[model samples]
Structures are given as C-alpha cells and as structure tokens.
Target: MQYNQRTDFRSREYNGRLNMGVDMRQPQPQAGSVHNDGINRQPMPPRAPKKKMGKWSRTLFATLFVVGFSVFLAFFVLESATDLFGLNKEDKQLEIVIPEGINTFQLTGILKQNGIIKQPVTFQLYAWYRSLSMPNKKYRAGTYVVNTNYSYDEIIYKLKSGSTKDETVNITFYEGMTVKEIANLLEKNNVCDADDFLEVIDKGEFNYEFMQMLTKNELRFRRLEGYIFPNTHTFYIGENPTSVAKKFLTDFDKKITDELLERMKNINMTLDETLTLASIIQKECSSVEEMKKVSSVFHNRLASGSSLPKLQSDVTINYVEDNIKPFLKVNNQKMYDAYNTYVCEGLPAGPISNPGIEAIKAALYPENTNYMYFLTDKNGKYYYAQTFAQHQKNLAAAAKAGAGVHGTTTQQ
Candidate 1:
C-alpha cells in the first residue's frame, strides 16, 4: 500500500510497457456485428409467427372449394346441353318416330334411345332454344328421317314441320281430259283406284258455295265432272283417292274466282251453263281463235229464233255414242240420249269434258258475228255460213274436199 503503482501511461511504459496503451473501462460490440471506426450496424428484423387453423376456418375453406368445383361442373353440363361445342356429329342415317300427344321430355328420351340424339336433356334444351325463334313451334307426330351429319337445329326444324321422307309422285292432268279418263290415269299411276276416285268425286261434298249450289240432280253424269280444272298436280305416293279428289276440287275452286262468277252473271249465264257451253265449244273447235268464232256461231243460232233451236253439234252426238271413233257414220249419229244435240234442243245436259280457260272465256264472251253456222273440214279448216243457201254451198265444197259426214252434221 505504501509503494502504489502509477496510473499514467508514461509511468506504465517506463515499467516495461505493461499497459501497452489499452483502455480496460470501455464496452465491447456484440458478435455477428461489424465495427467500422467505432460505429456498430443493426441485425435483420424478426420473422412473424404462424397462426393455428381453427374448426371454423377449415369449414369455410372447404365450402369455398366445393362451390368453385360445382360451378365448373355446371358450366360444362350447360355447354354440352346447348350443343355449343358442336360435338354430336355421327353422320349416320336414322329413322325416328314420335307418337301423337307426347311431351318434350318423352320425345327427347325417344330420340336418345334411338341413337338419333346423344344427350336427351341437352336436346330438350336445344328444342327450347329453337322454339324461341319460331312463331308457332310445336313438334309434330310422324315418321321422320334424321341424318347424323345435320345440325341439331336442322333436326329440330324437320321435326317441327310434318315433313317426312316419303315417296312422291307428280301427276299431270292435261286439259280437255274427261273425269273418267282422269280416274283411269290416276289408277294407272298407282295414286288411287279408278273406282275409288269416281266414288269420291261423285259423293264428296265440298265446302265451296259455288259447288254447293249445284245439286246432284242438277249436275249431270258426275258432280265433279268438268270442275276438276286439269293441271299438273303433285301427291304422296300412297295418297288416298278421296284426298286426291279433294285436292283437285280445291284447285278448281281457287281457279274459278268470284270475278268470273260476276262476269257470268252479267252475261245472263249460270256457272253450270257456262261450263257446259265451254265444254261444247272446247270439243267443237281445234284452236283458240276457232273456239271464239264457234262460240259466236252458237250464240247467233241461239238468238236467231229459227224453227230449229237445236245446236246440232256433231261432237255432242259422238259424245253420247259408245266407243268413240274418228269418223261417225250417219247411222251411228242417231242417239236417244238427252246429251245428243241432234235429238235434243238447246245446250247438252252438262259438260262433255273439262275445258281450259280460253274455252271458258270464249263461251262467256263470244265474238260479235251474224253468222249462224260453221263447219270444220278434214284439214281442220273452218267454213262459216250466214244463210241456208250459203251453208249448202259450203257443205258441197267440204264434201268435194273429201271431208267426212261428221263435218257435214256440224254444219247444220
């Protein structure tokens, strides 16, 4: 204690450098820290602690996952139902039948079962979509043809309409053909039986008022004889006779319009009378111009007030004869039937054959002429006569021209 050491660095250095210029009272820097000129750097920030999952949190996560998966599945199902991807393309020919009074679901099931449709529920949705575009859309019951190559829209279109893959036939009925001839032609074409057609034409009661006015007794021979209005007609291959006859009658009603009826009334002629005279004029003349002239001749004779009121049309006489020949003999010309213009006065009972529009117009409005008689030669050359003497001379000329007696009979 009496000999204490000196605290000064100079004294320590003299004592064999024991202190070595160090300070023992200063604080030290921590590990993993750098000191640059007595300045210390801070460490990195601490990480956050992980939270524990509770029962409610786990339920919420699971619920969200299930809802997302359900939405994805529902979208896939809807796309398939609408055929949005256009996947059902098989290109196979299929025959499908839908019975009467079936709902959309039943029809869809049937289509799917028949392999016509791959998805029933999807087809139902497709049908619903199609119905929106149509004004009145309803699936018809019938045998249908479905081609797999066709789109769903096309198949729905065919099903909505009653269109089917059935055999079709076109029957062209030319003008001037009689009802009997038409019946025979129908039978020959396998459209219907001749007897069935005749029966339907005779007994069928149409809704048209013009046809209604003409009773069974008023219409001679057949009720629908000259009213068929010959033209090209199309029908199903296995159509019924009554249906075919109805089509003909319907066409006739449309062709003979109300304006024509008014015109006939203005000319002091009934529908039956006009059709009858038109039929006679049609058979008498070979051409349209000749028909007008022949109609004039008949008009003159009717208005002539002569002792012989009979038309004396040779065709009318031949019409009543069985087995019509090219040349009618004098002996064969005598017929006791009311249709025989030679024996009967005025027009015949009814139309002899179906007349075209030209003949009908000719009968309705005859050409203005004073001529009372006309004759057709073998060459189809018509000779008109104003008086009896001129008619006799024309007859002599026609006989010299090698015309038959049928030509001579038409002269009177």
Candidate 2:
C-alpha cells in the first residue's frame, strides 16, 4: 500500500473536483464593455466637446431684448401723457358742481367723477405748480359749464373766473346821472345797498393815475362824483360795495385815453376842472350840437377876465337845491356856496354830475365863437347871445315860446 501512495493522491484529487461540480474553463469579459451572457459584447463611444456661442449671436440677442423693452416703455409713456394733458378728448359740454370750500384734491376728484378730467393726480400736480406762482388763485365753487376737450390750463382758468350760477344783473347808467341816482339804481336792481355804495364812493381808496391826481376837498359833496363813467355794466346781486364802485372807476380809467389827456394838457385844464365844466355842459344842453355851443359860451365867459369871472351856471343851483339839500343832515350854507356857480367864482368845487364822453370832448374842444351866453326853453331849443342886451332879448323870446326859461341869466 505504501509503494502506490502517489497514484492514490491523484485519484483523491479527481474525486474531490467531481464531488464539488466546479468548472473554470470560460473566458472573462474586458472593462467598459457590455456583457450579455458573454455573447457579442461592444465598448461605449466617447462624449463630444460642448460648442460655445459667438460674440455676434450674444450681441444680437441683447439688442433684440433692449428694443422690445424700449418700445413697450415708449407706448406706456405716450398713453400716460395723452391722458394727463387732456389731448384728443371728445368735444362735449358737461355741467359739474363743485361744492363750497373743497380743496384741490377734492376738486380734482369731482372733475374725475364727472368725466371732465381723466387723470386727477396729474391735474392736482398742475394745480400745485400754479399755486406756487399765484397763491391767491383758487378754483371757485358752484355749478359750471365745461367742455370735455378743454386743456388743463383752460379748465383751471374757467373754474377760477367765477360760477355761472350766481345771480347777475345788467344795469345801464345814462349820461349826466349823479352818483346818488346811480346808487338808487343799484339798490333798485338788488346789486348793492345804496348807502353802502355811497360810503365806498366817499372813502374807498382807489388806486388809479386819475384818482391819484384828485384833491380830497372837504367841500366836495362826493369824492368820486363825476368820474363814474356812464355805461351798461354787469354786476352780481348783493355784490360788495367796493367791488361795485371799482367797476365804474375801472371803466373811467379806460375811457380817458392818451389823446384825451394830451388835449386836456393843451387846453391848460386839470381833470377836475374839465369834468366840472363837462358836467355843467352835460346838464345845460339837450343835444350834442347844443353842448358844443354851451361849452363855447362857458369858455368865453371863463376868458372874459374881470367882466365875467363867475360861471353863474343854473345847473349848479339845481344841483345844490335838488341833490344836496334833501340829503343834508343840516343845511350846509358853506357847501352850498362852494357848489353854486352863481356865488362861487370859476368852476364849482367839483363836478355837479357824471358827464358822458361827448360832454368831456366838448369841454376840451369848444366850438369857436364870440357867444358868451346861452338859454334853453321848455321845448329844448337853444338861443345864444354875445351881449347882455342880446341875452335879455333871447330870454324874452325863450319865455314867449315855452312860458319857461332855463339858462345862466340870473344875476351873479
């Protein structure tokens, strides 16, 4: 048994292999290769390098984005501007009521609600801008008629002017009407109180070149007796007294043109004196032609030296008796003497009545004549004379014609 040991070991090894059922005869697959039962195996392909965009492509994309954004922004701005400025709106009238004492914000809100404005915020901004320059300017409250197409500036101006709903009256003051008559008319029309208007006329401080030249004579009955220009005017009912007086003065200021001022200077006549004479002429004559002739007679008497120093106007006596005496608390003999041309030398202390433009012109440019006296009959016919005897004849003729005589024929 010892001599056959090597052959026995080999026989044991073969038996151990058969018992385990182990086989090591298959080939191994390489790395990174697919192995599906080790049949038809293949390797994976390598990845390609990534490509980068060129400079021009990036620039084009950025340019397109910027252009698109700019177009959108421009369109937005155009729309906002159009609405803010009230451009291209419908032309339709709209009536709107603005409540009293509403501030700028409330005003714009009302406008927006009424379709009068599209952008309230922008309108308020504009109002604030204007307020910096005109602090006193504010939108007036009341019902107003506005157009839809009006610009912001126009809308603001219209609102600031006044309300259309306030009561207004048209008063026509005729030539030769005194301040008292004017006051009575105003009170009759419910424009203002007559006493208040007279108070303003006596004391109100009016600032005008012509008014500044006036002398505040205590003897003058009213401070602005003859300066109130006669015209048709519009006034608010129950208006302020000062405001009512200013309307008449403002018109007078405009009526005294540069040419008229030069004419007054050429004739060596002060404004008060010219108005005084014009007022006399206004009351004495019945027609424009008669006014010129009467103005000539007055001028002749004024230049007559010591022979005829006093105007001796009959109208001045009428003014004292008719206008002054009735209103006086006590009979002011001194005031009567100052205004009565029969007693006072030269022109009366001031104008007796408000004269019209034609009378004023006649005072400045009198008809060239040697006539020194004039008389008017009840029929309104005028007779002129150069001598005292001739005036007496004209007076008798006037008396025979109409049973009444009117002129400066009374003894001075």
Alpha-carbon TM-score of each model against the true structure: 0.56, 0.61
**What number of clashing residue pairs does each candidate have, in the order they appear?**
0, 0
- lDDT of each structure? 0.72, 0.84
For 20-77, candidate 1 gives per-residue lDDT tens digits of: 7555455666765667576566766788889899999999999999999999889868
Prediction RMSDs, each to the true structure: 21.9, 17.1
- Candidate 2 lDDT tens digits, 1-412: 8659988998888888878886546656686555766565566678897878889999999999999999988976675577655688898888888777878898888888988788777788888986774478667788887768766755765676564434689999999999999999998987766887897898877789998768678889988899999999998665656678889999999999999999989999989989989999998876997788889989988898888888888889999998899999987999999999888888888999999999999999999999877788889888888888898888889888867788774453
The TM-score of predicted model 2 comes to: 0.61
Query: Model 2 misses residue 350 by how many Å?
Result: 0.6
Q: Which stretches of candidate 2 lie over 4 Å from their true place?
A: 1-165
**Deviation from native of the Cα of residue 308 in model 2, angstroms:** 1.0
lDDT of 2: 0.84
Instruction: Please tell me which predicted candidate would have the highest TM-score against the true structure.
Output: 2
